[model samples]
Target chain A: MTQPPVIEVNGLMRSYGGGRTLLGREKPVIHAINDVSFQIAEGETLGLVGESGSGKSTTGRAVLHLERPDAGSVRFRGTELSTLGQQGLKPYRKHMQMIFQDPYSALNPRMKVGRFVGEPLVVHGVDSGSSLQDRVAELFKLVGLDPSFMSRYPHEFSGGQRQRINIARAIALQPGFIVADEPITALDVSIQAQIVNLFQDLQDQLGLAYLFIAHDLSMVRYLCQWVAVMLRGRIVEMAPTEQIFADPRHPYTRSLLAAIPVPDPDRVRPDRPPFDVAANVPPREAPLIEVAPDHFVLDHQVQ
Target chain B: MALLEIKNLTVEFDTPGGVVHAVNDLNYSVEAGETLGVVGESGSGKSVHILALLGLLPCPPGRIVSGEAWFDGRNLMALSDRDLRSIRGGEIGMVFQDPMSSLNPVLTVGRQLKEVLTRHTNLTGRALKARMVELLDIVGIPHPEARLSQYPHEFSGGMRQRVMIAIGMACNPRLLIADEATTALDVTVQAQILDLVRQLKHDFGTTVIWITHDMGVVAELADTIQVMYGGRIMERGPVRPVFHDPRSAYTWGLLNSLPDEGARTQRRLYQIPGSPPDMSNPPPGDPFAPRNPFATERCHREVPPLRDVGNMPGHKVAAWYDLPALLAAQSEKEQTP
Candidate 1:
């Protein structure tokens, strides 16, 4: 029996700068995400892999309703979040959260870490007073940080420690689903492994569903069970991690995977085509076709 | 004869807490026209050592406690300010991580490129303009003539970095130091830059000092790899031997920490349990001992001398364990399936 998805996103579209210029001329429209669709099963991770300007972050934010998409449908646990007002969305917001790429900027530096983490609880009115303190301390321990560090400022902690605090804040209200956007990209490799492991451990313990957005292919492969390849504001391919890695059908997905700098010195990287968007643009827009059981690829037919 | 040799290089910073030993009694030599890749986490002194060699570090808080950097039959440490200034951009060029900030935002790209040429060469007027355009062309910039008139803000990240490379190659320096040059760029762009540098190294016959934390980048670019940690070189050898048969446990940890290039599995990544050591109060023995899984009694109490591996020329490792034993243990771990 297939379990229902905790988060469902369909036909998501977002564009930037199209209305008018200072001279009242029509401005150029940059499609950040176009007709994107995906689902995150309960306690599952859906990896979104793409290069910069590929609309991965926009998709994550759009699903959270943080950046209201121009057109889309976002359903959280059978409830349509797109049509809900702020007051109505408040109840569902407690279950969904977001963890940013840069922990330094994501958190408020002036406030104490405890206050920052417990802010979610205060906003949601989940707990207060001594019980709030206990939850904050428990969160610290869960993310492998000392409880006493809650009183310290964000500057006192290292990058990894700050990220742990960020994770503590993200999971403070017992969020069932999180959009971790490039959570480990800014970290060193050694520290990166620690964060990835922590994410896995948290997923297993809390039964959390994650929309893991990142540019690192190997990292995505290591952490995610299902992967989606995004390019030019659309998902070109989506499949189980093993199958996608074993045999990627889309040309864009193949290029992206091959572009990754493998640690092996013997690996011969293909000659990279220059960053010309016009050159790689699909000659004909292809519909998402099922190549195998639950596997889809955008078969862009080039003229 | 070695192109550059450094001996007993020790750098320290006097802070409110204490003196932070950044580089301690390091000895290494680089051959002419070879790319020396330095891999280390932050505070490892890889960047600091080069900065010190280049006389780029500020002196009130920072001081080169002791060391001799021998290059071109002269001690770079003893060079006067004026003398060093002549050598810096003329004899050695540097490419920093953030190219946008490195290149002046207000200045036109042409003027910036010409300034580097004027400082080191006698070319002026039309000759200088021609050389600037040629340098831009060599670095793979499109419409070199038009790009010259544009400011740094007009160019993209990759384009700005190319402009920086053009400036670095303007003087045709013998040694090029690139510190985290490609770290900020995306993988595809990084591959392009790596390829450009690799090709430039051959074409220009310039020795390179490539410093970064990514082992994959080092493997792709550098002919030799130097694994550094806690102000010391943990391992140094040709890329193949150092990767295939790493004697240092730290190197092993770094290699294992890298996600396997193949398919994803249920296996947990190898994590080095602790952070890097504090420079102010560094350990008495192996700096990596606290995090090393195979650390022994000697690793904690006594420092291991840099010794040549048995019958492996040019491969030196600083560790307490014997080569055969370490390889046996590594192979055994690999056999676990």
Candidate 2:
């Protein structure tokens, strides 16, 4: 709490399909992310969880500057990111990286896995020649993949292995922060554990901060120190991992928790009614209110 | 009598690499009004066996090497294409994982529903339209009549899945097979879909074969659980017994791999050591033996027969070594430390 946070985002807003048409007809604007604000400290993971179209991925993209936000500020180590142009933001890009959901499409089909992993190092001008090869090999070992398989194409590896390749590339620059959007979603249940363990290991070893955006709440509880619940382009609740799981204050957060299918057969699934989004529309202007120590819930009432 | 029965079912693919053993010597039966959950990762043959039974698999590359699937006193394997077509959507309805791909993009939701009804039932004109509306309502789609004219792309992912379910339930089929039906949808939407399925089961007493890799989903919905690995059933039993006392190493590993919801401390997940078996050239012995920690020499040498557990009724496991004893000793060692 003493040192400044690694990444601090404030009032981040991004919308699509707005503005007047050529015919002067008004077009409806869809706010993908609105007034999203959070901070991730050094080596801490902030889990952004919600259903599809809730803008968790949009928030992550905006934070990483992959998608330029319309308004607000992204401060990486107290440096303003939203105002920076493409060329100006290049230096900050190395400190932040993103891993996408689908590993198959994220990788190049023709490119060797080694070259793909080392591409970041080459782009950043961190290393070259024999040293680059040695670094890529070290990265492969870090992610629990055999360095020998670096020569093989992506098609030769499985879903879990492909994800490790993506992770290796993401951490190749030794970035201070990473935005892993559903990294374990595509892999099998068994493979999911391995990848999760790798993420934890990498975080511990390198002291990397992560913006883990995913729908799997259980995995979020296991990995993240902080959790943010998103709904309709706004974070409805933000709290510590234990607090979010143990005592969710927001109605939307409680509903999300109730919806999770428990792996235990003996536990009877609660027959709670689905959260009515139409009935309880999250107020656009309402700010987050502190409910408990480090726990914030959106100031909105259920209809 | 069982609603559906399969014996010595084996499926293979004639790939360029080699003959891939997709499903091997599978034998099981689904009782009436019971939900059978088939759990497995990709390429485990959980979906393939169903495709093979329904005669949906493409010939040449994919072939049913040997199998007999009995349904309603007739062997599904012996049925002609015409006969199988009549029974597929009529007696046994199917809902696949991807709703977008399964549904026709060009046709309106109404048209697709009509197509299924026309093929299976004799309801015509107003009656058919009424039936379609009723189907949509049953699946919890709001304002079914207004929504029917909308195209597939017009509906949300969750709504489109409901439409898929409505189509599957159109003919009032005796058995419903949902293969990872809610896998693509978000958890909130998936919960709604699961609720809809649960409602349908309560109303019609429909026998369901729900195939998914999510043990959590299966635990919530299914009466019986069948764990598949490398195209073979590693374990099968009532959901409660199987989950609480998994006899197969693969099943045990899968259960342990999930993050324990009640764990006070965040501990490392118990990962199933190796990747899934390569079907192109699967090991002659137990398919999961290589990855299994407690695997013995016998397990690596020869395949174990699916045998009934000593005390648990209807519970069966395919394994060479005694898993319960091994787990007991392993736990005791950890506890002492």
Candidate 3:
């Protein structure tokens, strides 16, 4: 007997166009995600993190075919997603869904919350009538939304509430894996915890796997068991959470961890790394590098 | 004496939803050469308290109801607008979150930097231009001479922040109010900005009041921590005890809920339940009582004042329970397989 991994991305690649250099030749292509590979066992959350150009978001989108990959393959539940035809992939979308960071743009302003969530099921021909409404209420209840507020528009809810609606819609089809992209960054600090806890509760109850993409190291550390650090479209480091923090072998990882301002004054390092521009030279290239066990460093490598 | 001492601060705002209490009876002080980190979730009033220092918040919707913002022995709160303006940069500088928005899109970086120097230092013409280049270079903006003519958008997010820091230091003010200064930057750049702020504080002996919701920042830069909730001080003390053995349940939940590398074993974030109280209708008891696990009848019926836990050296926490024991319990819970 065998159980399939929830989601698997192997050797995925993508790029953006580059501006011309001073020498009047085309600049090196931007590697959004290059040869990235990872897996999330069923019900596990794998965190993706990095700076602005790190390509973690691109990888998530590429895995879902929201953004096409330049090369490589993505498999979900042993079915080759990259090889699936456009028509073939539509049905599989029921098993995978994505949640975006911006709650304001993610929801349909014109449609009410009930209709918005039920749209997917209606299109998929899953349910209609009282059963659909019941399912919508169930979905709302499942995501901790008040069923009474089903008819309300997205504007009636706060940022946190809107994100809950987004989650309800994502899970409407009972997807096994979800890519939650920065779902709480725009939320209030106090409200962020509620949403995070809700995500946690949902994962436990449904056995859902999450590719939690975010930049907050502290938050990611809490939600994800295995984390993959990306920089310029390359997976710089991938590891179990404890080892990465306890012994961050990569210099970038060390610097990232060290920079977390410890709130404890007594714990404040008496000596701090000097802030010198000499450190952080605009990468003469890209993809810092693989240095140790499940850790990668991006010092300088273009694509 | 402390360089800045704020006592009895009570700022109010006449929002459409009635008089909103923003900062309520805030009392804290920063030494001449020390950093104070004012931490809280949004609407906890830390930002208002800091902004009230400079009289920056608009008067129509916001008003300082009562307070003594004594900086170097002068009452900044009661000072006239003109008087406050005179001291805003001449004695104290302010930097805010969102460098993208805080910076003027049309203005050149050099112009903004030089304006501060000219306003405070009585410099002009070539002397001022030279000073601007010098200031840019000092802030680690490479090739300051060539870069001076470039507009704000031309620079990267991190570089723009450095420029803002240079402008803040232009007057060499005794204090800098960095309200979420590095929240917009990435981790690498955030470190750089934090390091830069610390270095500037060290080099110039400038007192810093960093107002942010980020716990990591409170951990990294604060010598002292003040946790705010419901427009009042929930706890105030040195940073170590606040993180290690916080008495306030709100503070405890905040620390636990924050994700970090060490917490991979925990499948989910230990987020504090419920929403922050509506300020207009703040509960009579502990603001965090609704969400707090250890809250009791007293916690629900009456507010817990900032009671001195007085356990660790120089540590102070405000809570009804034996928080030290709670912290031990938390540690044990986290340690379990």
Candidate with maximal TM-score:
2
Look at candidate 1 and give me any clashing residue pairs. none
| Each candidate's clash count | 0, 0, 16
Candidate 3, which CAPRI tier? medium
**Candidate 2 chain B worst ten-residue window by lDDT:** B262-271
Off by over 4 Å in 2: A1-3, A20-26, B334-337
Tens-digit per-residue lDDT, A1-303, candidate 2: 444699999999999997899999999999999999999999999999987898999999999889999999999999999889999999999999999999999999999999999998998899999999999999999999999999999999999999999999999999999999999999988899999988999999999999999988889989998999999999999998998888888888888898999988899888665687757767789999898898889988421
**TM-score of chain B taken alone, every candidate:** 0.95, 0.98, 0.92
Candidates by DockQ, descending order:
2, 1, 3
Q: TM-score for each prediction?
A: 0.93, 0.98, 0.87
How large is the interface RMSD of candidate 1? 1.3
Mark the regions of model 1 whose C-alpha exceeds 4 Å error after superposition: A19-27, A270-275, A282-286, A291-293, B323-337
Q: Could you tell which candidate, 1 or 2, scores higher by TM-score?
A: 2
Across A1-303, the per-residue lDDT of candidate 3 in tens digits comes to 033688888789898878887888997887777878888899888888877767878888999998879889888888898877789999989989999999879999988999998889998999999999999999999988889989998877778889999999999999999999999988878778789888888888898999999888877777777877765567766777766777665555666676666545556453434433345433433543555565544545222
DockQ, candidate no. 1: 0.64
Model 2: lDDT to the true structure: 0.92
Which regions in candidate 3 have their CA more than 4 angstroms from the true location?
A1-3, A17-31, A82-86, A109-111, A155-158, A246-249, A268-303, B125-127, B259-269, B311-337
Q: Estimate, for each residue in B265-324, the C-alpha lDDT of model 3 and write its tens digit.
A: 665567677776777667777777888888878988886766667666556655677766
Q: How far out, in Å, is residue B48 in model 3? A: 1.9
Candidate 1 structure quality by residue, lDDT tens digits, B1-337: 5778899999999999899999989999989899999999877899899989889989969999999999888899999988888888788888989998899988999999888899899998999999999999988888999989999999888789888888887899888889999887767677777888988888989999899998988888888999999999999999888888888888888898888877664468878787778889998898888888777889999989898984568899998977569668888989999
Q: Name the lDDT value of residue A274 in candidate 2.
A: 66
